[model samples]
Target: MMIVCAGLSAVVAGGAGAQHVAVSVQVSSDRQFVPLQSYVQGEVDGKLLFFCGLSDMGLHVFGQGAFPAKNFSRQIVMVDRATGAVTTGTTDHLPLATRQAMTVTAPTAVQYGSILYMYGGYGPDLENPGDYFTRALCTAIDLVQVKNALQASQPVPASAFTHTECVAGKVAGAGIVKLGDRFALICGADADGEYGSAPDPEYTNVVQIFDRNVSYVNPVETLDDGQGFFSPMHRRDVNVLPVRMPVDRAGFVVVCGAFESGIFLYENPLIWGEGDAVPYEDNEFIQHIGGYEGPIASLYSASHDRNHLLIFSGLSGYEYIDNEFVWNPAAPWTRQIVNLHVDGGVFARELVLGEMPWPLTNAKLVLENTLPKTTDGQVLVDQLPFGQPILLGRIYGGIAAEKQGSVSPTYASDAVLDVYVTVTPEGPVEVRPSAFSRVRGLHVSGGLSDLLQSDDLRLVTRPDVFRTSAVPPVQIQVVGTSPLQNPSEIKFTVESRASANNISQRVRLFNYDTQKWEQVDARTMPLSDTTIVVTISTDPARFIDDATGEMKALLQYNALAFTIAPIWQAGQDLTMWTIVP
Candidate 1:
């Protein structure tokens, strides 16, 4: 389901002041022989090179028989982007060590030029049965030669592959990116035993840099805040992309990652530049969707001085219900697409673009039509033809969930989709306010009948708190002109000042289903004047009466009598509510 916010501009749209651009996905008819997920891939000369990944959805069990060797992808797969022809090569012809290291799941892989470097993956030991360990090996494959050998159904030449043993390559699910001549492997875990067995998995909190030949080039730099309480860099299975930094420099942005303290997902991102000695955390922006590793594409619009990172469907802590934002504590798998916009390489904001045709995780995008790009591969969107739909790329193998959340059944995705982007002329977006009325105890200090009718801060709405009996509940009614239609968000704003005697204030929403007032923890009282904005994500039909087209909110103020009696005052204009319709 595509949920378009009423006033949101088109994501990644090029041209100065362009506000409308359509981003969409078209499913291809071609299908793979078997499903694959959590794999490493490289694209060269219109051919995609696939290596080291799982053939099944994922391991559901915790320990012991978690990673079964039978589910490991044993063949080297290749796909022709133009013709949709697939070619497979068996790994049995290669050495056991090389085969085992190249076929493990969730290894850090990055393609520079034509060479694909894959490092650190976890799987069953080929030499020792039932024993699974994170491989401390790095394998580099010549994409051109490997693709030729696999197409002819010939044994993969040993010279086409090279393996290196390095202490830094002992982790799995890390993100690898090439900055200049050096490669950086960031944040993953080293599993010593079976999954979830004794000896818990250890997280590598350092970024390991290596040379083109897969040898350590720089001393490992740790990612921590010195206090050692909770570091944002302690993450894995994250989306790391090569981006254009300020002043046309090269850098990397590590997006939302998994398991903060082995439980929650990290919402913010960490950025590193080629000139900097260490990466810094971006705590200002919080990522609500696509919190797991998935297909991502980056574009830089030089004309507009903006960088756009397109994030596909993946696991997230939030979801949209009919276009309204709803928080999900479970961090369920979502099909929502998001665009992270960085203005002038500094300020950032997340825009909810549409969603994919289906839920995809651990997928990869291969650009079919190459556009102008920087040294680090960020597409120069300004160079793209305007007012035309450009074929961005083709999305490949990943895990497809039957439904959202962990309880749903899943399978490795064999589906391929062609992504497209179109930029159009700008148009004005509208935001309207709902008519509001005071239903209960609040006495209007101004002549205004509706507190939300205008944005006049001088118009005050006063509620008497000196009443002896439970100060008659101050109930406010928000009336909509029409019934709830498409997905949209309703924002309730309250600007009020409380006297020194005021202890606490509470806001509650009336639920029609349960016929109860549910307390909403939007903010804490500060005694002084403050403004609180609460976004309502619940279905409008559930809260708004169908017959009256009205929704009610109850405000309760608690105060302790002291030398000065408690008084509460609210700015009528600033306390107005608006909705994205």
Candidate 2:
């Protein structure tokens, strides 16, 4: 599933309107602001750096972290957007007392002097019975000390330097950013103060700013909303990241949470406004901001320039799907309807700005008078299937919801969808396979497409692994269908799943070469009434090999309704598969 045949591993090429080629960097973890199970990134020197905090769950083994405190061990392991080089370092030896005062669950980090200041999280302690009771405040780790010792083997920077002390709490949400010439960190409930007699503090609007151009750094209190500052504030799952839009010449911060009602933002931090606040349970704000029209759904706030704010993909129930809506700036909560077209030929579970591994999902819309287009004068389309190819269908699992019956906790078991296509001798033979469901969009690309385009295609396939190491020849069997009159080119595709709001599966293609399975290039085609065979033996070779894995092509599918006895159902039933071995 990782090594797809669509775009090159290091290089990618779209249809015709492709501009500059983009390379994908494997991000180890999510963002730094959240108390992730793994890594986080802190911004320094105008660049994002990566770090890892203590994670027992082993979620992000190579994840990153940002600075949370001044007195803890901090190091700079990566430089933002650097693809050529790799850097690694460690922290200085901690005093016996300092070591005893830290815990892994309470690790902290903060950005200072272009370095991430990391500190203790949940750890064992000698001061209290069992494990608890250390003052949850972490000191900053100096960047200069860590960077200077990069080439050295035992490179733990010295802790003799005095570090700043703030909330030694576990970091969550997005890392703080500077506004104009000021430094600020936007955070919600502090976990350290949440337990025991202290019980931690709840959601509070806190903005700490520092003096300008000072040689020695000392942050000043800029604003505080006392608990109700921004009530219905972000919960644990949501994150607040500051953004300075070009329109108002002011700073604005966006708050995105899970299952939340809408997106929220602060126009000007210096001024205070008594605005109404909406509440949400498990929210996922915005993944990437592409364009905006107005208030998309319930997420809306005042705007200095335009009215809408568009968002791409985010977290939801058992599956993650793409969400597109425009929020009005004046009303902030109302949505202005507009089409935020999806980019095609790319897939992803998560994506970041600039050179991310996948195309931007749920991308927030950027207001522009002119729409984007492809290199060949075609308009850029994100989710819809195109071309003359026939759709082959897909495979997936069934729902586990109580209303769906059975009542098993493991709802999505072994369910599948299969598509079949037939083509005349010469009509159209090119096909693209695309799938959509509650899981977003996954287009079929790579060698499958090449097998469809070229001749001498050999395909070795395994249904279990859903991959082939060799190229697959196009296989077309003539049946009762009429042969194409003036056969030009034939295409095929399969729409086997529902939209991003429902259960969908992935469909891939490969070629058979010599005596093995070779992954091939393929695309998702639009569904149609009449079926067409887009695949023919592009290359001749031996039979498909099942030694490596299952040889049958299988598509994951989920049945929405039951199959009754006497009374017939409206929709198509029974799993479909091509048995041409």
Candidate 3:
């Protein structure tokens, strides 16, 4: 039986009878002599093998495109990229007739010319962790054609590899990618329940790299073993384990959800199982740039930089909820919450409080295609090794008594309290909030319903607090009138309102020490119709101006307000206000 292989072609219709056909000849075949492994598109020696289908006989060339090549019981004809033609190849090229009876499970394959590489997956003797048979994989190279058959096809003797224990069943999971001068097969998880039974700390931590011209792959010898790349964890039941080859990174490979612990990367070849696997102990491993509430579901590397990874929502195992964060390998992954003033989108159109932007793509081109490109706010400008001090705009909305007591006005009094503000972005991009300006007064809405009214100037009021800081639950100094004639009680409160035309308003208090805004407490009266009165017994010398001999109040109350409105397009019509007296 003669094996037929041909490259695919394309025809372009031009003026009149003039036609152009783009033809690229493939002197090789995708058919291989081994069971299929995972399939991927890659360049071998600068040649693009468009459609690569896997079979135990040999990696066959079905065409030079993404052509469906499953079900061997049917005819085995591959298309040619050069002539836009299809021709029959070898009759024994595939074992599709009896593929269902094959004992191997999770069979996958990838080909570069005649060289077909098959790796990891369960086959035949399926057993539990204890009784499971661990078989490795078989690697075959150079199944070139013996003769150039027709002008349209090439002929090669049929070849197939026998399954071996090295790559047989021990191959639990694998993904393939061609890099530089070799093919890298990332082997992971447990196939036969070995790790599930007694539990091995190094099961999913292993990776194998195969060089060009090698027929067999030795997991221990092929590539770098992940040393400092993994976080150690006790073995347990695992299901729905999924891995992906993110495109942002040029040459790096990352695997996630081994036992639902965390994501691991091969920053350098042979990185797994080498140095300390414990993230806390191993300083060489890529430090987590930030902490995410849940395990990562997807990670996208920057198109230009490999050091940055964009993480998307995934389960934290606790809530099965999705959280996002940007992970920089150079720094320890720390979790941060950034309050953003949002208008509309998949995420709610309000200020995202106690939340941060999830890093998932290359920072270089994140907002390149947005309506208008933003340079400063949309991108990360600086990095604080220990997180440098930043100015967070604050709006004082309310206040609370730390401990109930007859409050007195004195710098040494334990009742001395601090203030803070939480500044959230009004849009998706980055923003730097300015300090509260007395010139920029606060504008309070009559009520929640007042916010729904458009062009209703009467519904807007200017009685809100105004303040500034660069921290969450921001902090401020509470100053009031001094030398009180009679003791009275004062109450402070913050209320927020949102509507469709002009909705998405929020308020939160601040903490002086932590330098951030405390969650807003709205029950306190924002502006009580009645003033809080306090008794004063201090010496007149302390309150009276030395030159004027008149008592004056040193402390003052602060207020702030914010409003957002949508006028057809997104991120338009917004107002911010702050007041202090």
lDDT of each: 0.68, 0.28, 0.25
TM-score of 1: 0.68
Q: Encode model 1's per-residue lDDT on 228-314: one tens digit a residue.
A: 326677788888877777787777788878887677778788887766766788888788878788888888777676778888888
The residue ranges of model 3 lying beyond 4 angstroms of the native Cα positions read: 1-114, 125-135, 141-157, 160-169, 177-179, 193-204, 213-215, 219-251, 261-581
Q: TM-score, each model?
A: 0.68, 0.36, 0.29
lDDT of 2 at 538: 39
Give each model's clash number: 1, 171, 110
Cα lDDT of candidate 3 equals: 0.25
Candidate 1 vs candidate 2: the lDDT winner is: 1
Best by lDDT: 1
Q: How far out, in Å, is residue 8 in model 3?
A: 37
